[model samples]
Target: MRAAGAQRGRVKRARLADVDPSLIRPALAGLVPYEPGKPVEEVQRELGLERVVKLASNEGPYGPFPAALEAIERATLELNRYPDGGAYRLGQALAERYGVRFEEITVCAGADAIIGYLSLATLGPGDEAVTGWPSFPSYVLDPLKVGGTPVRVPLERGRFDLEAILAAVTPRTKLVFIAAPNNPTGTTNTRAELDAYFAAVPPHVLTVLDQAYFEYVDDPDYPDGIAEYAKAGRRVLVLRTFSKIFGLAGLRVGYGVGSEEVVTAIAKVRRAFDVASVGQEAALASLGDHGEIERRRIANREAMALLTQTIRGAGLDFAGPAVGNFLFVEVGDDAETMHGALLRKGVVVRPLGPFGAPDALRITAGTPEEIDFLSKTLSDVVPAFR
Candidate 1:
């Protein structure tokens, strides 16, 4: 019996080695998985520290709005059943809020998930999708996952270079993703730039405007994505998320507004019941809680200002006055080293190595105390790194 088992194990190993890796999609093999914010538990376990501050992943540190808790409690009774795949009520709420038709909306688990649906529905082998680097990685990853070529235009002065992106476009270009108050840098393109960009892009090329931090934006020139949809000619989609200012990052609810055709194509490949029942309910409830949203938004702005001041006082280089609820600070050579030092010190921040900014780190805005802790840790640790 021992000899027979040994023979079976050998045969299994040999058979596995015989399968050609080339059979797998060529783009998928080396693809590194997305890294989310470091969980509190993981850090505590790693460092043997009871106290830690996690300011990564750009998530609002606040809990769900009061009304959202009620919705979650009510939805708890329906856990046995699948969520409404159509997301009728959520769709209706968003449509009414934006003054758009119901057919133009498609609710998904997150804006990142909508990117997945877009990739599955539109991208194909040899197709090209364009986006700015030092920005969201998903825009590049999603296209590659579908065997589409990703054309990354480098940011000019920490912002999207629209002209360069347009110049890079070819007949094979199928999609473009623009993240407003773009991640890492957190700067925005003006309304004039987007208008010019829309005009330059060909009708065959679809554009996705990711407004994940829309509610935090206070800039007068920050173009409204819902309004941008009206200006776009052929193919355009606006993405918004509940993960940021709505303080529902755990629930993973996001939505898109676009042409009926784009919505239809994405829906064709959309994962059914993607958004949870509780997530949908919480999102709907939060939308009506405008007072809470405004309060949180105002609070975030104050916290951001405090952090920016600290960054300046420490003589740290940073992108100025971000519209989003985060700041990008330059930490000199080998960001991973600095990142490790901070991790050891019980403060968590996102190193931008994967985002192509190895000299910098992105920090999500936290409360006054949290920001002060980060600033102090950074001041102490950064000198050692230098």
Candidate 2:
């Protein structure tokens, strides 16, 4: 009987190698998994260091709003109960806050979840989702995961080539994602540019404007997609999150405002209790904390300026405007080498090689001391650039 069991195990081991790879969906087969920012705890654990400054992810260093913290505390008692599947109260709050119809609003786990919903709601096999390259990784990955073609238009000098994006549209194109103040690049389109792009977009296609870092932006030229969506009466979705300026990254709450019909379609496939009770309460609390948002915004601007100036002083050119709480600076050395050197110095930053900027690094705008440490660390590690 033991020999027979051993023989069965051997047969299964041999069959594992012979198993058909086609069992997995072909679209997702070649898809590269998204690489998230390095966690602070991970660096500390790996390097056996107690002080690790993680400026890899563009998370705010000031922490979440006090009210949001209190809300989370208040919500702990309700953990046993499942959250409202419909998210009725939070949905209503968002609608009133954004001046959109209550039916036009939908809350989800985050912008990433909403992106996935958009992919499934709009895309099918052979259909395409158009977006700018090096903008947001999920903009491409989400559609590809759902067996849809991703049409990537290369950026124009670290900015979206709106004309090229429009030209890339085809009969199979069901959606287009515009990451305003685009990720990794930090460049944004002006009001005029957005107006022209929206005017020319075909009515058949849905344009999703991802404004995850909207509050961080202070540029007068930047166009507000929410206002555009409200006035244009087009098939548009504006995605915003409490993650960035609100310092609610851990809560994972975000919302989308769109045409009621489109919101309904996306809501159909939304997972039950997608946003947690704690998350919903925290985000709702965050919306009312304008003072915290403004304070963080001001702090971020100061930190971003300091980082950008330091990079420029080092004779490294940033790819675009440092509109977000991060700067994409040309390392002037190998990205991996600088990344490793900085990692050794307990400075965790993100390499832009995965974001198609092989020569650049994305450093988040952290606290003043952290920024000073990074500035000094860069000078020591990449002296040639300095």
TM-score of 1: 0.93
Q: Which stretches of candidate 2 lie over 4 Å from their true place?
A: 1-20, 384-386
TM-score of each: 0.93, 0.92
Q: After superposition, how far is residue 44 of candidate 2 from its true place, in Å?
A: 1.0
lDDT of 1 by residue, 1-386 (tens): 35444542353233434576678887897788888878988889767888899998899989899999999999999999999999999999999999889999999999999999998899999999999988898888888898889999999988999999999899999999898989979888999999889887888888999999999987888888787654344368999999998889999999999988889998999888789999999999999888898899899989988988877877778886589988898876867887888999999999997887889988888999998898888788877755
**Candidate 2 residue lDDT tens string, 1-386:** 35444542343234435567778888888888988877888778777777889998888897778998899999999999999887888999988887888899989998889999989988898999999988778888889899999898999988899999999999899999998888888888888988898889998899999889999988888777887665468678999998889888887888898988888988899998899999988888888878878888899889988888877766677877668888887764577888898898899988976676777788888999998888888788877434
- C-alpha lDDT values of all predictions: 0.88, 0.85
- Highest-scoring model, TM-score: 1
Worst 10 residues of 2 by lDDT: 7-16
